[model samples]
Target: MTASLLDRLMDLETAVSYTTPPPEGERPFTYQAGDLPILISAPHATVHQRRQREKGEEEFTGALAQLLAETTGVHTLYSCYRSMDDPNWDRVSPYKTTLQEIVQSRGIRFVLDLHGMSNRHRFGLALGTMNGRSCPHFEPLILQTVKEQFQQTSQGTAKSYEELRWNHFVLNHARFTGGVANYTVTRFAAEQLGVPALQIELCSSARVVERRPLSQWRAPFRGQPDAIHQAVILLQSLVAVLQAAI
Candidate 1:
């Protein structure tokens, strides 16, 4: 990765965490214009109200989306402020509405939703494509590319990239089949808007440092350079795969 890219990602990591939420009536997510037909997104980048309850931020996801946009020249939509609506879970989310408008107006063909899971989660990354229902044409390619990139980047790590192959936890799996949750951004994009979409659930070891009172608050990489480096690698792999696929 270029120093500039890493530096920019570092800056974004801080920005996403410390930035003040916009006043009510203002959109929480910011759209980064791009010429590519692919759109990168991070719906849970910050805390949000979901199903009448507050949900914790997903840690570096917004920065990851921004990094992907910078590296791959793809359109991006990321949550920059605390969400008033659960973009991924709400049935009528303004995020999705705006997504539809962008897909239609910009002729976007792919939507990649990035998320982060705590270290408590078993897998390093879990890819969701609405259980094979979303992005019928691009799911296989997306899945294959992610697997290959993981194997290449995580060869000697504690997590065995090869083992992940047999785990088969990435797409249409039990924990997050992207099925039954039609309100999810990916499901809505595929089912309603007719655009292919996928949700990538990343484990925190690669992106975050969970703090006290775990539910709705935690810090991003903060002072941890290693965490940031790993996140950068993940973003680079994702951008490489996406560019190839696109």
Candidate 2:
């Protein structure tokens, strides 16, 4: 199963070259429609430009989004090519525009924007809801669900809740407060589209099975299979609960 997961992620990683845009007529992102009212987005899955500066890809976030969609039947939008604009940082971009269109047309009620953070952070997962401005009605349930899911032991996962809790799980940390200082996809969907949104940032250990070969700077690192397994289960649980409640 872990090997299958790695292969699936690699397939997504190869869909577009990390340093190049898609063909002239192609979009930088791909959207998959699903049965649930939730929309999963991974805007930084590939290299992106912010204020004329380039930012590295977030490793496996795109693949994670796709995996979530496959497992839970939730709508998904993930960047597949290098971006000329930062969808998460920039106030306006084609990606955000497309997101708005998807939410409107698909009657999406909740948006879960996926992102990745460095392993140096002292958290397993950090959820940003703009300090509850976004997803106000569902915040408590979201929190409860996350805590419960991560604490439980699934069939094949090797990590116990105690082991996973070493880093911790947090909500609304000042550094990643849903980009309150800027217009993030979470903020945009919540404010402009009047849809609930949450920014779910996974620590590197949870999200990345292994860095792609194209990554240049960081020494090659592989995430524990147990951690990845737990993450997948946790996210799948969130989607299941949200779909039922929403």
Candidate 3:
């Protein structure tokens, strides 16, 4: 293991119980911090285990999250869905049961879920939740950070969410459509569980095409690296915000 991985764990509340269990032949283990007030979870990670896949969006963000981790002294993150699992369409397997068990066992405060959209509309980080269910003012701060970062990266010329049009139809629909658990995790994790939650959707064009005007992700995050990096930055930045929340 790398030394930085060790550094990722210090005051963390110790994670346990993944959404799925791995069999005897898994390559390795990918874990996250469960109970910290700031929980950065990426639901579009991959299958790292034979029967289980554990990872999050903040793992790779051009080393920005790593820098934040060191500067902020943070330790905890989560991922429940593989790139193939699109909770937006329907919630097939909600780790909510597992998350509930963890939250009840550990008492987590906030849940920040990382995701990306292919809707041809969204552009920056989103603070979508179960509708006025969480920190209502979350979007403003998230937008501020994202816009600031956009200016810093020299990555894209896309303005903040305000400058673009947003399809807000999927704001608080916790109940899955067609049994596919797309936004179910965030909805349940925050609304049902009473845990303040945030869902961030990154665009796929920047990651897949590596060009301007990121295309909205239609399916799942099958091949998107840039989106993952952006997710990481958002997660780490949110962590800092949580540190202030407490």
Over the stretch 115-174, how does candidate 3's per-residue lDDT look in tens digits?
A: 444535444334465455555656557556666665554445433323332212234334
lDDT of 2 by residue, 38-145 (tens): 999999988899999999888788989998898889999999888999999989899999999999999999999999888777677899999999889888998898
Cα RMSD for candidates in order: 4.0, 2.3, 9.2
Quote the positional error of residue 243 for candidate 2 in Å. Answer: 0.7
Determine which window of 10 residues in candidate 1 has minimal summed lDDT.
160-169
Ranking by TM-score: 2, 1, 3
Q: Global lDDT of each model?
A: 0.70, 0.84, 0.43
- Where's the lowest-lDDT run of ten residues in candidate 2? 153-162
Regarding TM-score, does 1 or 2 come out ahead?
2
Model 1, 194-234: lDDT tens digits are: 87788777776555533324335544333234444555666
lDDT of 2: 0.84
- What does the lDDT come to for candidate 1? 0.70
Best candidate, lDDT: 2
Mark the regions of model 2 whose C-alpha exceeds 4 Å error after superposition: 153-167
Q: Each model's number of backbone clashes?
A: 0, 0, 18
